[model samples]
Target chain A: MTASMQSSVGNPADEKLGMNLTLRIWRQKDPSVKGKMVTYKVTDISPDMSFLEMLDVLNEQLIMQGDDPVAFDHDCREGICGMCGLMINGQAHGPQQTTTCQLHMRSFKDGDSIDIEPWRASPFPVIKDLAVDRRAFDRIIQAGGYISVPTGTAPEAHATPVPKADADAAFDAATCIGCGACVAACPNASSMLFTAAKVTHLGLLPQGQPERDDRVVNMVAQQDREGFGGCTNIGECSAACPKGISMETISRLNHDLLGALRAGARPKS
Target chain B: MKKAVMAVSGIVMVLYLIAHMIGNLKVYTGRDSFNHYSEWIRTIGAPALPEQTALTIIRVVLLAAVVAHFWAAVSLWRQARRARPERYVTKKAVAQSYASRTMRWGGVIVLLFIVYHILDLTMGVVNPEGHDASPYDRLVASFSNPFITAFYVISLLLLGMHLRHGIWSATQTLGQSNRRRERTVNAFAIVFSTILIAGFLIVPFSVLFGLVD
Candidate 1:
């Protein structure tokens, strides 16, 4: 077996090698309440376990001890959902580009101290411990992220032939799972990457061309309205993004925005 | 829209800086050649369009670019400030460069330098030779003072820092940059800014050391 697989908790030999980690996590009762770092210790963590699973083990221990367990947002336990995120040791979604759920315990060594915090943007106010409000993203999407589709009948798959290059580009932008890591990592807390990804995902296709002008115009307007910081083109967002979304996506959004404005496009009220 | 405005205006300013540097380099040829070029600029549109008309137009365009660039920068900066009222307790730099992060403050210093520069050279108000002397004589006199030379050199260095990030960001803002050419675009900025700033600095340094006279 691979070394990591052999280190699973069921194996008695791995128990001696199990890591004891120190976690300093942010804890808040509610949005109005003040938050602070609260430290906890987890013992005998299997190298094969994920980061979130370590937290799970901590919470299970807490429940057994009749103490309030730390609250966090998570689902799927897999990377694709984009539902889980944590500022692990000052990095978005931990030290790796993958989501917190995908980061295994083996990524760290025994006796390591990890600091976990929620997304820090004002637009993403802390909800509890590691969860923050990201509904602002939904509003930006509602503003113009959708294409106008005819609801009467389903369009044929090959009805419109998309170029090989554009289809790939669209798919690349489409991979953004609305995770708040981009905002967390950005110095200005700009949502440029998220909005740009959505804008370019649709902006690249032929079907997307119809609303391309309005899409860029309104989505950007909504982005500004949400009080998210403007993009300084510092590239922290793309760097911290788990999907590996390219900076070109934001560039494409800028190009579309300029063209839209020159064409006298206005955001819908 | 604002990003485009900043990008376009920044390009206009950089293009003018390149031309300005090349024109300033005429000092090495001889005082007569340098002064002659300055005089030639005043009469650029002499017969048909009238003297100083082209120069005035160029000045007006540069002024417009500066105003537009400043306006966009301020609005975006204010929005950015409002967006993140709070900050992370432990935020670390991942991919951002020191030059990129220093753009805002560095741009302000560069702007101050431009004002001082125009007063000393273009207006001759701060030059020892004043408005009555030849352009070459004024330059030589101005750089002869160690303080004047120091300020000029410092300002040019700051301007170079601003341009390094400014030019690179302009490409990204204009959608000319991509993942594959990230290094290429960045190196282009570093190389162009270094050369342009070096060209300008050499003229002043030469004058300070008595090479231009």
Candidate 2:
């Protein structure tokens, strides 16, 4: 394991440390309530504690006092589920890839104050304190994803053998966890990263070929309908992506979208 | 449809710039040709049409295009600001092309220049001394000022930046997606946008440096 992966609870050096930390956390009863940044003082936090674990301790303290624990979302704390997200200081996921759940306290200095809050965007409505409904991304995907394989019977896995290059590319594109970090990091709040990923993932594969034209057209249309901004190709979204998704995908998506449109215009068989 | 809206509006704007530059080439054709060409523009939409109605329509449509372009830009800017509410001290916007990086403030500056341009030339308002100069005289005198020429030059550079991205984006918007067509469209956008910057730049320099005057 690398140094990055070794700084867990079992690490000896991390067990010996504790520190006082300031947390300016966002508190809201629900999506309806107007939210504000509320600061809390936390002490004796283990340096090895994942950022989410530190939050767990803070919540435990709040619960002991019969106060409502600050509400945030997390699951599969190993970073695959894409549930936990936060703006720490000013960087998304508190300054790293993966998620807030995977962020270690060692990334920060002792006696440092941390600002934690939910992702802020009109499309992602806050569910409670730190969780926002990222359904806008989902709606964009629903416009067209998935091969048009019908309802009942399942095809044998190897029956539709895909090209090795296509399969690898699709798997890479499929790594996107719908985290909405790309939207958060973008300068234009453009969903190009998420939309382009979906467009490219399926667009490149033969299984997805039947509905390729409709997929690009419909998904792109849905992306626009959702009030997401057009991409300017500045590429900040790719940098912030935990999955390291590429802006080159946007170029590919654009190319495919045009191909679909042209194919549609030709005289049908 | 925001992407399509931007793409379509951007395409129209690009076409307008190319046509406008072509029209301006009448200056090189001597006074009669220049004046005749201006008259021809009026004649095309003549009778029952007020003088310069076509030009007026084009200007209004271009105005609408500009408004749409900027409105789309502002909406996106606000969204980006909200999405990442945290400001990083490491604000060095490295790795982005300089043109793409400075788009926000550069766009604002260009917008301001556009407003000043209309008042200075079109409406004959705020002409340095506040005296309304004829469009021809306004063209001459305004470009004559070193300060005005410098401002125009700077704004043109910004316009160039806007076009660098806008051209490629507009083609993508219009559904030109093949690598062959994409490359061609992108090259066309670059060359077309560059010519506009060059064409507009030349008029001012020619006037200021006595090449045209």
Candidate 3:
């Protein structure tokens, strides 16, 4: 219902019941062209409307006026898809500890000048206004983030006999949605959390034991190769993650990486 | 791989600092006691080892640690710098602690200070009494001057800040820290760095106040 809230369109500020707000949004025509914060006034925004819904209202206004609509990515507006994001007022997913799609407009007061920018990182290049190319993340995942399990019938769930603690921990790490919010929030734009999540998600599993050494080494190499910054363990990535991925996953990655390097592991690629 | 190098080398240096701070507290025992302590460092494992063999080993290890630490830090710094060529137009603080943000530049400052420290204290090139003086006398001579003492204090403060973040970060890098133990690890870093730095700082302050002199 957050995305479905009605805005009193075209109504004067005093006549409308909903809140009026100013948006300072990053508007870039393309990756080659420079971007700037283009301010727009949105009126009669419903308190129940999600942050994206508010933007939706603005984009509607722009389209009606023959102006190019603001571009932002979204799929499941329920926050789990990790498709929608923005640096709403300098925060990765706005002020709330949730995805931009899930963040309700109620968090802001009337007359607020919200600044929306795309994820800022060298690797995640801004594709357009409020949307960045997150393929750097895809490359990182491709770099040994998977186990070499042969294509066959699905194995029995109980066959693995995973320890309860390990299963719980692995599940925690598996929640990382590969959203670049971690990179955007990171001071160095490091993808440690995202990489670590992938590393540890399978790292703690019994099936992950075979390629453990190679996985850590190759993935880390690819991460560096993609021009992502090194991790300083600032804990910003985990803090900004929508899935609430714990920093412990990063520790596990570090531990695995050290052991792999000590054992002289190299990339299978 | 680079983070591991930094963590390992940083841990080595921290271990040495703890021992150095403990030995530094011997200054309160008078000049002979402090001088004997300095000589005692060399005489460790005496019967089986050649003169200064132990000290030489420690120096070699410490030197290796410093070099490795510097190499890792610089490489990581370069990577970080290159990672974000296009800076955020809306500049905002992302790091949790001021100490965390200062690790890179502060480490460089600490390294530069180390060179000055070695020249002044160990080599006695910048020491008022010169290298021939007893270790205690050299120590007293450096702290006796307001400018020298001031430099030492400033350097130690900066080193403390570096150590504060470095300790916690090393744990994170080494996978020794976790969510449940996060607060404990944080407090341990703050407590240990403060105590160790204070132990080192006490001697210079005492000397400057004429207590150790």
* Index of the highest-TM-score prediction: 3
Query: RMSD in angstroms, all models?
Result: 3.7, 6.8, 4.4
Task: Select the stronger candidate by lDDT from 1 and 3.
Answer: 1
Ordered list by TM-score, greatest first = 3, 1, 2
- Interface RMSD value for candidate 3, one decimal? 1.6
Clash list (residue pairs), candidate 3: none
lDDT of 1 by residue, A26-135 (tens): 98889998889989999999888988999999999999999889888898887888889999999998887889999998889899999988988877888888888889
Query: Chain A alone, model 1, TM-score?
Result: 0.93
Query: Which stretches of candidate 1 lie above 4 Å from their native place?
Result: A1-16, A64-66, A150-155, B47-51, B128-133, B145-147, B179-183
Cα lDDT tens digits, model 2, B55-144, are: 878889998998888887777677566544543332323235666777788888998998998788666676753545444565777888
Model 1: lDDT of residue A78: 79
Q: How high is the DockQ of candidate 3? A: 0.62
lDDT of 3 by residue, A1-269 (tens): 33223323343442334689998888999999988888899999988889989989999999999999999999989878878888877778977778889899889998888888898878888888888888888887788889998989999998879999989998988888887888888888899999999999999999999999998988888888888998998878877888888888888888898889789898766
Top candidate by lDDT: 1
Interface RMSD of each: 1.3, 4.6, 1.6
Error of 3 at A177 (Å): 1.0
Give model 2's TM-score for chain A to 2 decimal places: 0.87
Indicate the docking level reached by candidate 3. medium
